[model samples]
Each structure stands twice: as structure tokens, then as C-alpha cells.
Target: MTAPLPPLVRLPLLALLIDAALVVLFVLIGRASHNEGLLGTLVTLWPFLAGLVGGWLMIRAWRAPFSIAWTGLAVWAATVVLGLLLRVASGQGVQLSFMIVTTIVLGVFLLGWRGVVLLVGRARVRRAALLATAKRMSTAG
Candidate 1:
């Protein structure tokens, strides 16, 4: 059997996959809302993907794959800003309202999962600590 991947490699790969999936979902939803067919949506996917890649590079996202402050917020902001800039540059219409909507939606999509993960991680740590304390008390008693 092949050896398992180290956390260093696996975590970054997982983070990249999750972030890319969120970006694609954001694009698909936006296009669907406007009744843009699948083919049309596919046509517009590149700009967002470009922004996502730009964000990943700017943040060096792999360094702290699970950090909301360092990774989530930075990535979300970069994705929206860079995506819109690219959209404008590519002759795609980007109205003020569209910008606002995209920002809010992508913010939720990208950061929501990170927030959940943070909460769960905290809970796990707390639980483990409590268990450790209980075990020590039981043993001492």
C-alpha cells in the first residue's frame, strides 16, 4: 500500500479544494439566479477562478490553511476584489449593486465554512481538556 500523505501536504490540498469548490458554487449560483444557462455560466467561470488563484498566491494560503483571519478573510476579499476587477477588465459588466451582492454572497460562501470549522475545533479542544481534567481527578480520587 502507498504511504499516507503528511498533514503538511494533505491540509493544503484540502484547503485548496474547498476554496475552489466554494468559488465555483458562488459562480454557479449567481449565474443560475439570472437564468444564465449552464453553458453561459461556464463561459464566465474563468474570472472568479482567476481571482481565487490570485488570492491563494497573495495569502500563501497553504501556510495557515485553517486560519479564518489569515486565510478566509484575506481570500474572500481578494476573490471579490480581484474577480470584479478582472470582470471589468474583460468587458464584463460589474455594476455597483452587483459588486455589493457578490461581496456579501462570496463572503458567506467562503468564510461560513471556516467559521464553522473554527467553532468545531474550539469545541473539540475544550472537550479534550475537560476529559483530561476528569481523568486526572478520577485517578487522584
Candidate 2:
């Protein structure tokens, strides 16, 4: 198996890699032009966390390949609504378009990555089952 890539590099590698990529991407974009403040930072981070939660629910649900993607979009919408409520309570009308776009971007990135990991795991299991069955049949024959 060519040394098996160590324990840390085998399982959970995709999620870790995707998270690092998202962090770098968001930090760069948010900090660009030196105009991003605490609220801007929060806006970027909020949907990423939402995506993680949605992806987790997807894994639990385990119904379809697109489940995670749909869940992520739903979570992004909920975050926008929550942000709007906050803006209203604070006496500032919500910024709809910007929040929607940014949250969707973050949500899709995180959720998509997690979905890929789950799919890969499922595929591996299926392949193993098939191989086991084939081996048993061959030996019996």
C-alpha cells in the first residue's frame, strides 16, 4: 500500500485540507483593502460554522448525495434571516445581497468538502463489500 500515508493523512484528511483552504481564502478576502472590521469577520465566519453543522446533519440523515448541498443552502438562508433580525433590532436595515452572496460562498465551500469526504467513505465501504463477496464466491466455487 506504499506505506499507507500515516494515520493522520489517511482518514479525515479531506476535511482538514478543506478547512485550511477556507480559512486562508476567507481571511485574505475579508482582510483585503483593510476595510474589514469585526462585523465583517463575523459575517465571513458565521456561514462556515453553519455549513459544518449542516454537513453534520447530512451525515446523520444519510439519504442522498445532494443532501449536504441542500442543507448548506438552507443553513445559509437561515443565517441571513438571523442577521437581518439582528440588524432590525439594532436599528440598521439589513444588507441583503452582500450577506446572501458571502454566506452562500462559505456554506457551499465547507459543505461541499464535507460531502465529498462522506461520499468517498461510502464508496470505499461499498467497494470493500463487493470485494469480500467476490472473494467468498470464488473460494466456494
Candidate 3:
């Protein structure tokens, strides 16, 4: 029987899945806005997907999957830059307006979740510290 992976190993996988899903959601929204059909979703999505995987590999995101600064920024950059470049190479449209929208939307979707996680983690730590301080004060009083 195979042993289950530890939390450290599992977390990166979860992060990658979340990132990929958000990228897909980005593509879906864009395609839907254009009145494009689901049949061409993969056709439209591959460059961005390729870029996302490349980003994860380039930054070794597995090392710090939840680090918004470390992992999220690199992933967002690679997804946008490479995705756009690949689209140009693949003879897809690369208009200024589209590029702007792509950059903004992908940035939000990719980094937004990580930002929330970071904030939540910070809040939890702060709450814990406050509780500890309160407990200490009560005990001393």
C-alpha cells in the first residue's frame, strides 16, 4: 500500500489545483463574454495553461505554494506574459484592450486568493497573540 503524502507535500498540490481552476475560470468568463462556445475552450486556454505550468516550475512553487509574494506574483506574471506571447505565436488575437483585460483579470484571479490566505493567516496569528496576552494578564491580576 502507498503511504499518503504529508501536509507539506499535499499543500502545494492543492495550491496548484486552485491556481489552475482560477485560470480556467478566467478563460471561461472571457470566452463567455465573447459568446464563444465551450468547444473552443481548450483551444483558447492552452497557452495560458502552458504558461501557468511553466511559472510553477520556474519558481519551484512547491517550495512555497502559499507565499503570495514568492509564488503568487511569479505565477501571475508567467501566466499573463507567456500566455500572451503564446497566443501571438498561435495566431490568436492580441489586441491592446484584450491584453489589458487579460493582465488585469489574471492578476486578480491568481494573486487575489493568495492575498486573502495571507491576510487570514495574519489575522489568526494576531488573534492568537491577543488571546495569549489576555490570558497572561488575567492570570497575573
Query: In candidate 3, where is summed lDDT lowest over 10 consecutive residues?
Result: 32-41
**Each prediction's Cα lDDT score?**
0.88, 0.56, 0.93
2 against 3, candidate with superior lDDT: 3
**Would you estimate the TM-scores of all the predictions?**
0.91, 0.48, 0.92
Q: Which stretches of candidate 3 lie over 4 Å from their true place?
A: none
- Model 2 per-residue lDDT tens digits across residues 1-141: 566677554444444445446644764575575676877666655544454444435453223323455544554444445544554665653466656655666666647666877799899999999999999999999
Candidate 2 lowest-lDDT run of ten: 58-67
How high is the lDDT of residue 68 in model 1?
A: 89
Task: Give the per-residue lDDT digits (tens) of candidate 3, residues 32-114.
Answer: 86766876788789999999999999999999998888799999999999999999999998999989999999999999999
Q: Which one wins on lDDT?
A: 3
Clashes of 3: 0
List candidate 2 stretches off by more than 4 Å.
1-28, 35-74, 91-96
- Clashes by residue pair, model 1: none
Q: Tens digit of lDDT per residue, candidate 1, span 57-114?
A: 9989989977888898999998999999988998999999989988998899889888
